[model samples]
Target: MTIPTPPPGPEPLRETIARHGLDARKALGQHFLLDPGITARIAGLAGDLAGQNVVEVGPGPGGLTRALLDSEAGRVVAVEVDTRAVAIITELASRAGGRLEVIEADAMRLDLTTLCPAPRQVIANLPYNVGTPLLVGWLRQAAAWTRLTLMFQQEVAERICAAPGSAHYGRLGVLAQWTCRCGVLMHIPPGAFSPPPKVHSAVVGLIPHAHQPDAALFRAMEQVTAAAFGQRRKMLRGALKPLGGESLLAEAGIDGSRRAETLDIAEFDRLARLHMRRAAA
Candidate 1:
């Protein structure tokens, strides 16, 4: 569990990428964050990693992976879907003095609960294409991880932290905010990446609430959000027609004339609770 001083990898990240022939693959939504200082800052956003097992997704060239190791985390488990990136990080694991483990698999398919023991936090510059889905999946089981410090495309990050009535607010904001205390930690310009992405990116930190929604309630919330925001332009009475419509709104004590975006998280939670109750009956 001892991390070597000066960080591992004999060569610089750019050189390592060159030596390994690891070009940023657009198909995998890869945008490599090779700057150690930036990566270190990202790791720092996770806060007090000591004795915490940290899980990293898409550890391209292991820049952030190295930072996590240096953070003195109890253990760092990196999951990479790209074989090329996996190979790169596998080499990093070798220098980590048994403190790092690399898993070559699609993070979407893996059960995160089984990745490691308790006191876990997920810190990563997530692959853009799969980032939202990954966050949604993790949000469903929000209580499992201690905190999730992740990077996402700027707009997506806005959506996650967006408030009701804001243009960016929607289902993502509802689900994430409902279960966790979320905020934007930092913003990164496109130039920070190996091959800069077209859009700016932002890092978001989410600490799950002590009282998370139960399975049924969560499902109800999902259903409610999908129905409400699916046709966001429509009033609740119309948008929610498929899910008991006006009657559901009436039961939940919500105004049927309201548009989806106007409803706050508590309103949504109430709708979800009523939706669940009706479905059960």
Candidate 2:
């Protein structure tokens, strides 16, 4: 199908909702982002979507779908768990000129790298309930995408981009920062949705590292971070006891007295590497 050229004038999303009898379904964790301007801004942040394969998650009622198609994006493969929403987005695909493919499945279950052409990038306003789990799954396969521009509750966004020693810093911050450069792009007020969520939302982007820390080291870092931040208030010597306490810190040349939040990415990597060498031995 040829990509549908958006006709001149407004797309009339609200009118479409009224005509189609669409309402956000809480069962699906569906809160449709309703602002056209916000949609346009999100698509633009993807950085030259033209000819790039883009993946969008939870394309409820096609708000962001229309924006992505209007932009220069070459192709968009949207995965939606809600079957009802999938039907609506399929119509969006036709209007999108064959450039949009609607996949009726959970984003967490799909293999993004295998679904689209290379140079893939993910851009979406994720369903709130499944956002963090989906993100952690994607991070596990970070090499699959060139970049990702995603919208999440502001709290999750903070966790992803949090600085070391900050209150928000934890396993999430360590895992995200370990492989990618991430930052918040925009703050979306709660009022911008059909059924506005309780908390505000934000857009954040991730650009994966060109060369990651060693694979074994990276895994060990994740393990160490999980143990440390899983008990954040405890001293590192106590928190990281699962990975061998003072001996692990000593081998990594780090001070065991420090708390988890105080260690930066380099120190995390150092611990990971130390764990790796010991495992190899």
Candidate 3:
């Protein structure tokens, strides 16, 4: 089959989708982004892609795929689980003049660090079903990348970039902010995709932290946040009953009477540090 060349004009996106008869698959949580302008905007947020490796997930109809290749990126490795989409991506990859590599596999099951080389960046309009887990996985293995620019439902984006004590703040916010510098670069309305998703979306960028103040303290930080936010409405003492409860707070210099949602990220880190010290001794 002759692979169609990358769209040469502004309307290439819609034309490609129509020509290919590519329909978004609900089973894959697929939402085809058909706006070249939006794709360009997203790629711009990724900063300098020159000679850098980028991994894209769920490249439905290759909207963002074209943009990444158009950028100066050395290579773009697109991972798509859907068999049909994978076939379509194969065509897109061929037309990309060897800059795009389409992988047919489940992104969650893959170890990205091993898949792509150094100077890596992840830029994707992630599938809604798997977006959070993917973000958490990448954030946990943060040493693998220099930066990540991804799209998610607006609510999830807010949670990822939310400040301490904000209503959107929770385990995701704490973990993401602790390991990386996160910011929301753009807000995408529901209408941006071919089949508009019910919720609005946003692009977020995360630059991983190189020097962690308390690297060993993350275990306790995870335990503390899980307990605290697990019962956010309760007083810290009551909510954290499993992990030394009030005693843990007293030792960490945090007030036991405060609710979990009210505590900031600094306080969480302090508690983690205290827990680490106790464990060591």
Candidate 4:
């Protein structure tokens, strides 16, 4: 049986915002996506959502929310911090016949793994200010998500997929590349949003790796990378001195004089393993 569409029409997003006197809050990094073509394309980048529960971070004005519903997703649990946007999303939920749920909460603090059933795909046009931190948080618990189709500034998108030798390579690159296979699917200009951001934006798809080291080992990786890249310009010996200094590099068979930017994922894992071994000793 085909699902019934929502009654004739709902007010346009512009009108919804206007009537509510809503404007993008710079503090929240809120830039409402207003273009249906771009929104549809962003939804499409997630691939088939036929049986997937999609967690949308900021469904401002319900533009992308509407697109996701139309994408035949199994369900969408939209988490919005702004109350103004909440009303719009909630109204969309009523028309969705239960497939869409508007949750009034902060995505940063929300426990998304339990928000919906397993095989959850987190798809969102993330607020710019919080985007990187949110992505890092999700990376820490990569096993909880099946896929992450997220929007971030183009520079950030580059950092996510950057190779070891590039200028963009750093802590974000190390963690993201190690935890999942990620790539930029498409670019959306600043004009696509209601209040355009200064920087260009890109949609990224992150599919987690099947074989990740356990939590203990992952924590060690984080520690090693954090110290190595904390100053970033310092050599491994100086940066990692507190962790074990040159001995740690010797144990991992890495050069003590090299900077963090040149170390590939495998080298990072080598250092992480050494860090864990010495810790267990």
Candidate 5:
């Protein structure tokens, strides 16, 4: 399908920033992505947004927001906590002829499932300070989103897509992989941002599983993973001692002597399932 050209913005991004004195605040973990080519490329990673309702978080200066509008998405909801950005994008929304909706609020407190119509997809350059927490929250309700194309610090991205036995693997990897199919889409240099972050950044894509574990099982998985990885260096027998220790490992068919990092997603799932069953009994 042919993609529509992005509507022209009210003004150049730089001028808009200068006019509004929109400096990137350190407290908010703000790193503005100003390059049109990069923002467009980030938007492209979301893929065929034609009829999709897209939600973007931390849309500073509306750089990525403009690109989403260009994709001809059925609707583009830009949620920004900063009122300055909200004012800037509100102007862009006016020029967008109703395709754009700008909401001023903290993304962390908002429930995305009730925010838009499906098939819903979240595409954003998430703020560094709250990126991981927001991602963990989304993983809990992974089925609500059709896709998640998010930009996070390179290290955090590795943790999300890391495999068992790897140094980066831990609770985040277990929870993320269990809920969705995740992978790093691209690596972006620190220089890509207006005020570059000290470390590099990478984009990650997550598509929820067709058959997700129920709430009880999910909570069980959280408990098991937290306990196991809380002391990753300890053997399962010791790490999971509070949860029945060796007995729990034996019931789940996992070796008591193995470290948490040595166990894969399926093994973790087994442990969580058994833990849930035992709790119910």
Candidate 6:
């Protein structure tokens, strides 16, 4: 017997998850977004999603998935790790008139740059556990995306857009700002999630800058930031010891006494460049 289709809109989110006996599993960081209004607004932040390819990570119960499809996005390629949600995503895809594609693959393992169509925007309420790592991967391949509208824990969101001298400014801030123009799009409370997360969440928008340095420079920044922030309490002179400490700071034209959180993206770029010089020498 052919089963009848459910009515459209946000109700399907709750119904689908309930019908499938799916609960938000903590291990997967699965806090499903049941509010379609909020999801719609998040999709809206992508700016004229119509005729644009969108990559959605972790489409639990197809809530945001439906929002993206309804926004008239040209196509949506949802990469989901949870096999349980596949059926729900497939249902959404079927309704999308061949515009939606669901890949039962881990977002972290999949390089979206090689996977999705060009002129793509990534919009998702990212699984909290893997959000930061996934974002780092994307930023490393920033050229592939037109924009990234992603959700992360409020703290992480702040860190991504934090300026130098701010308490949240550190490795993530430096790395994110190094390659993209980052901002907090909207703040979501813990209550917004089905099983409320311990902390608030925020949606962030990252548009790649015109002048991202080469891979080598990125690596250099990674190395330098890792070392500096690894021992953040210590001054640059002490923290960057393996890379010549005070001398390295001098070579970069930075003060050896400065701390990691005080350095902006430009300073980090300079430090990365200097680190590369040291490696070459």
Best by TM-score: 1
lDDT of 6 by residue, 78-108 (tens): 9888887887788778778899898999888
Better of 2 and 5 by lDDT: 5
For candidate 2, the per-residue lDDT at 86 reads 77
Error of 2 at 220 (Å): 2.0
Off by over 4 Å in 6: 1-11
Clash totals, every prediction: 0, 4, 0, 0, 0, 0
**Angstrom error at residue 11, model 5:** 2.6
In angstroms, how far off is 105's CA in candidate 1?
Answer: 0.2
Taking the tens digit of each residue's C-alpha lDDT, what string does model 2 give over 68-154? Answer: 988888889989887767767776776666898989987777788888988889999988888888887787778878889999999
lDDT of 1 by residue, 1-281 (tens): 33224344457998778777889989899999988999999999999998999999999999999889889799999999888778778888888789999998999999877989989999999999999999999998898999999999999999999999999999999999999999999999999998999999999999999999989999999999999999988999999999999999998888899999999999999999999998999
Candidate 5 C-alpha lDDT tens digits along 238-275: 99999889999998888999999999999999999999
Residues 62-84 of candidate 3: C-alpha lDDT, one tens digit per residue: 88988898899999999988776
- Candidates in order have lDDT scores of 0.92, 0.85, 0.85, 0.90, 0.91, 0.88
Report the lDDT of model 5 for residue 210. 93
Flag clash pairs in model 6.
none
Candidate 3, residue 216: Cα displacement in angstroms equals: 6.1
- In model 2, which runs have C-alpha deviations exceeding 4 angstroms? 1-11, 213-215
Q: TM-scores across all candidates?
A: 0.96, 0.92, 0.91, 0.95, 0.95, 0.95
Candidate 4, 1-281: lDDT as tens digits: 33333345776778777766779999999988887888899899999898999999988888889899999799999999999889778878888889998899998997788899988999999999999989988998899888999999999999999999899999998999899999989998889887988999999999999987778888999899899989888999999999999999998899999999999999999999889988999
Model 3, residue pairs in steric clash: none
